[model samples]
Target: MSAELSGTEPNRTEPNGAELNGAQLDLALAELGEGSERWASTTLAARADLLARTGACVAAEAKRWVTAASRAKGLHKSSPLIGEEWLTGPYGVLTSLTALRRTLRAIDGGHSTLASRRFGRAPDGRVTVAVLPLNRYDGLLLHGFRAEAWLRPGVTAAQARDRAGLGQLTPTTNGGVGLVLGAGNISSIAPLDVLYELVAHNRVSILKLNPTFDGLLPVYRAAFAPLIEAGLLRIVTGGADVGGYLAHHPGISHVHITGSAATHDAIVFGGSRTDAPRFTKPISSELGGVSPIIVLPGRWSARDLRYQAEHVATMRLHNGGYNCIAGQVLVLSATWPQKAAFLEAVAVALAAAPTRRAWYPGSDGRMRAARTAYPAARLLPGGRLLVAVADSATPAASWSTDDILTTEYFAPVLGVVELQGSGQAYLDAAVETVNRDFLGTLGANILGLPSSIRRLGPGFEQAMARLRYGTIAINAWTGVGFLSAAAPWGAFPGHTMDNVQSGIGVVHNALLLDDVERTVVRGPFRPFPRSIAHGEWALLPKPPWFVSARSGALTARLLTEFAARPSARKLPRILAAAFRA
Candidate 1:
């Protein structure tokens, strides 16, 4: 990958990014290499204990973690938008740690981690491992939300269990110094990558923070002090040059980065160093791409239209649309009777959502490109766009050619593409369109009602099987897959160095399952009071993740605390804050 990542233009994004020099970088890598053997040979029980202490440290630093992230991303301490910081920052990390610790404990106890997890068979005969509702705590914390991993075709549950914990059989032999070039946008990404390298691969890691997140180093250092103190991890900070050097250092046996495809190519192909790799190392990544959200035609209630509209809005605007999994393209059936009405509600909901700065680097240039592509694009409050489709009902619509449709905008830009069909025809066409035209394979989402899904039946699952994406979500934002540690988050498996669409490999898979084809996440169509009237009985209200959520900060704060240290006594207050949102 290139030494620098996307959103690197500090003149536009933020002014807080930091950097490290050559001497310190050299020392950090050496230190990490020195601990590689010890960390790899650490007993499973001790590893579990390390993660347990990590959780405590994270809990202790949770407030400062969110606060630092808030300031870095342009949110004031009092901004309710701090909730996004809380959830994506400290809360996500704690949950990942909690899951990893459980996996370690399970392996140490000589028990199957999947024994208590749910599993099912897709219509195509592939085994699917249920990833969410991971426990009573998760069930209550994220009521009505669920996710499952659809293993590679023909994989059985037995095969899945047999293949997991690849390095566990002989951890000492797997010891290596993994260099982690962290992502700039999400605060949790850096630490999450560190955890994956250590827990899943038995590697001591040297984490070189993205320049964009340099200011949050202190919070990260405090939260991960156990690993740092134990010599299993080293934290460094810098921009492109630093990362470039670290990625190629002699002591580094492997490298993993979460950035752009440009960065991935530069490193793998020797950017500015004769179009070839100067050093060989196993490198992995989770590069952002043009993710799609498919909405099948359904007989929906007025509340369904409104709530789903808000859901779509949240998907586009969350974290001010810097997220890799945020819904970039909206795929819909042009023949659906509710098309115009739904579009209208989406526009209204988008405008009604709270405003946040276009905080990422190069946003101005990207927004300009979007404006040039769609001259009629409506410029909403926060440089957001409700892009127009040139032909609202056609497979050959030229609107899909815009860079906004093909490239990862990494800003608040949503392009609506309508396919001409209804029912099963619409489903098949939508899947084909995305598979053929979308630029990346990281994630895709399908939104429809239970009745419509039931109507499609086997056809529905078959459609999901046909779509090629790493993580597929039904009636939910794919971002949830990124947060859930049990689900593997990365590009769809088969990509070579020549054409690394979303980069290669997976991370944050706490269960450590291999042979994963894609993870499917589902959520309630309606929330709370409306859900009860509709007999959908899922307890979700306006979820705190929604950008418009009123009590998001308070709710996420409570949720973060509970995740760090779950207690039955804390459930009532957490639920109160959640429902209040």
Candidate 2:
């Protein structure tokens, strides 16, 4: 019943001989181009109201949204992971919409300040903006969690202050049309990207849906009716032919896509090397890459081992391992005494976790390819998680040199590689390995105890500066950066279309800063009450977003409603539902 195997015909017509398809594309582009100026001239207060309305519309349609997503992913209506669809699908999108609305309202009131507070500065002069705990609500909901965005080096406090409302600094006298190629994996990506283009960049957008999830076209149209009615947005459905036509269209002034690096190259450059570039429009992309998690060498109790083990498992297993920021490799200290115990704990967590359908396209083929490259990989029961260990002295024999290092498995398969060294030496070596050997400059994770972090103090801070990822999470999953609408999310700065690694531009930056290096988020290894590692009681319930949680669907729905309109009366019910999970 997977999408690939399903016999259902595509909701949109194929481009073989469909004249209507070309006409529809032309109409959408023309409307977007014509409406650009009107949308650009709208006042901040008016725009904020529109965004709020859109968020309310999405909140009201939450059930329909999750139902459609669940059916597409081949999950039963009663499945626990139905909440996955709720949280990642509509809930995440609503969060972004609400955040954007708040920013616009602040601008309207002549307070063009970001929700994050300035925390610290890196040695290289990049300022760190703590973007989480946006308000008392966030502090109450997600305790002990913090996220920050590191401004590009050389950006001073004066420049940061002046750049607060960069996106809305000047009205677009003659606005242009933008083409948005939607991502198939996450349902929120398309709508959220469209919001950025229209609200932040001052451009009207034409959103082309990926064929795999074209069924959501109706739902999107309903949710985004305000924009559509304003003639500032249009949604279309088709395959690569449709995408190519829209990309090369004369009306498209700029393009933003969320897909593979190959697709970006094909769009920016020509299909063949000998062919000249067909579309010269400026393009920005967020593509997949091999992400890594570095575990610093440290003394640990059994509590730390089990806690971090589940943490690593959750990072890799979430979303069926289809996330671009999912941890692909585990970098460990070869000399650490507890390395073996930690690995065993991770194995146990992976085995105990629930299994999800390998729903994404080409996942089976990619899994087979990874198995071929690493013959010794251990396939856990039910074939959900693949654990591979690589130990070699020479660089050529090391997993770091294998194609798997650069290749994004996009499945629930994780590779473990141990590097020789201890303390700062191991940390430095690990940083160098990911920076030089890893393929894309997307995101990376670092895990360590407070003592270990302190031991490497200055060295640890320097290591954070050295890593070339767009997002870094210490003792936290980088996915938080992706979900934090206020934080700028993209590849590291300075990538051209010719050699695009992760991507060329950034998005989800509610602050509207133009020059952004990366976002760094940190969380405590163990938060209040009892540590899950110590087998004591936990202060927080298992995250409702986890696929294994039985009450995921109900908890996610309640949480989304609360986010839309916070009510003290709703807290007890939400907490009770979360605890049941």
Candidate 3:
């Protein structure tokens, strides 16, 4: 049964392998012998081959994988249904492989096509690309759209090495086993993190499943069997005690987690202050945060406001608001005429949005905590409680940096803070709030119209420069950008050995050891209707038929088809079915 709202302990379950008792810990550590050397000797072509096969295996068994994943998370079978889009979802892994393969061929021939804009080019000439779904509609809307990225050579890599303070590539003297505590909410985060370590930093990782979804280990094991055979990865299961044992185990080298800060402190400082830190090894974590969404006012049509309002609300409503990267803050200019309309649109969206199953153990407690603070908070009468906090106060004093602001609710709670000032003032205040006020730095979002950008002028540029976040999504929700894989995923720029809010380094985009600080940016599109905004895709209860558009699954399918030539004739039927759905 679920816990009560006011007074209930966290639901802790002990699945198999909780203790990390004997052989499990030892075998995983043994696999990590001389880390980078083991990885370096393995050529990128070979590595690509392994990942490609894994993708093929995943696609072949996409239905089984999705069912298992959904079951493990206690989601209805209807949710995240495997189809052409969801199965292939949007990150074109095949395209990424083709790009990587081409880049490798170029490297062999002493020339490269990486500098081309067909991929994407950042302001600094970084080989940046955007990853979206395989569907045509999304393709048309995201005018500057690029596919998922995969390569070791990019202008961004060069910049990261030069100005980003990224240290020299250092090989490990004594390879230590690393633990990857997977987030239960997202199916792809686990595989992506493990891949980063194996390919980039050259580390062997034992993936520890979150208790909420320990039942799917069998499926993941089979799907990732290649990495297992390569001696680069392992997947384990259990609850808190298992995690504790693994964290303290001397065999473990570093640890990477995607959960709450409380979990991090518990592992790092030990559950009790008196006890020693859980692990003496290096630990890097991307804990949850109250990610902000800055809506920059711009040339308006009532259509733009309505579209964006729904877009913003969808981010919070996705996964029943379980994502660590969910948009929590709505930063808007009070002077903007459309602000009120946008808010109303959001409310309407929330009202119409379907309720999701709130199965996580302590969800009630988190929901109540948010509600007690904001009495007038609107609660959707359904499965999960979606708390909406609208703030109109100006002095900033009215905003208390309490649990709602500093801590991540991990529930469906939306907080709107209306800043009364010029465009520049709002940008400056938003940046300051993110830097000084919030406790996390995993992800952030900015919703600005073209007019807003023109109005802010240098102030907008200055604000973008000042904002400290790993994934600073310009106009879309931060969640979409993070999952793109083409974009580097990590802490904002300027983070280093001492400061690590956005995280210690980058993981996705195949950039390991990146020296990225504020990933300042822009997204020209106001709001997208057919987006995986709130985790739900294109107005569907379950994911759309084109599920592959959302990153992991999508990347896997594309790579599979690219590797094994499926008939081109079938492509039309698949596309037709997806869009029609």
Best candidate, lDDT-wise? 1
In candidate 1, what are the lDDT values of residues 1-581, reduced to their tens digit?
A: 33432212211122344334566666777787777767766899998999999999999999998888887789888888899988899899999999988888887877667867788998678899998978888887788889998888888898787777756645666568888988889999989999988887888898878877878888888899999998888887656766677777677889898988888877777655344554468888889789888998988878799889888998888888888888988888877899889988888888888777777888888889888878998887656798866445444656546676679989888888888878899999889888888889999988888778889989998998888999888888888899898988988889866677887888988888888888889887777777676556688788899887889999999989888888999999888888777
Clashing pairs in 1: 1-263, 1-264, 1-267, 2-263, 3-240
Best-fitting candidate, measured by TM-score? 1
| Clash count for each candidate, listed in order shown | 5, 1, 32
- Candidate 1 Cα outliers beyond 4 Å, as residue runs: 1-19, 272-279, 392-400, 532-535
Give residue 396's lDDT in candidate 2 (0 to 100).
31
All models: lDDT? 0.83, 0.78, 0.56
Between 2 and 3, whose TM-score is larger?
2
**Residue 372 accuracy (lDDT) in model 2:** 84
Residue 365 Cα positional deviation in candidate 1, in Å, after optimal superposition: 1.4
lDDT of candidate 3 over 1-581, digit per residue (tens): 11111112223433543545446555566665544346556654565566677666655654566666556545564443232223222233333333333333333343322333234444333444333432343343233333433222344644433321111133233244678988777666777777655544556788888866676677677767777877777787666766766666666778888776666666665544433543457877666677888877655666666666666765776656777777887777777777777877777666665555676668888888877877777665553333444345545665646566776788777777766665777678778876777767777788775555767776675566566666677655666555454456666544432344545556655322243343333443532343343222233211231222233233334434533344556454434333433
Model 1, global lDDT: 0.83
For residue 118, give model 1's deviation from the true position in Å: 2.1
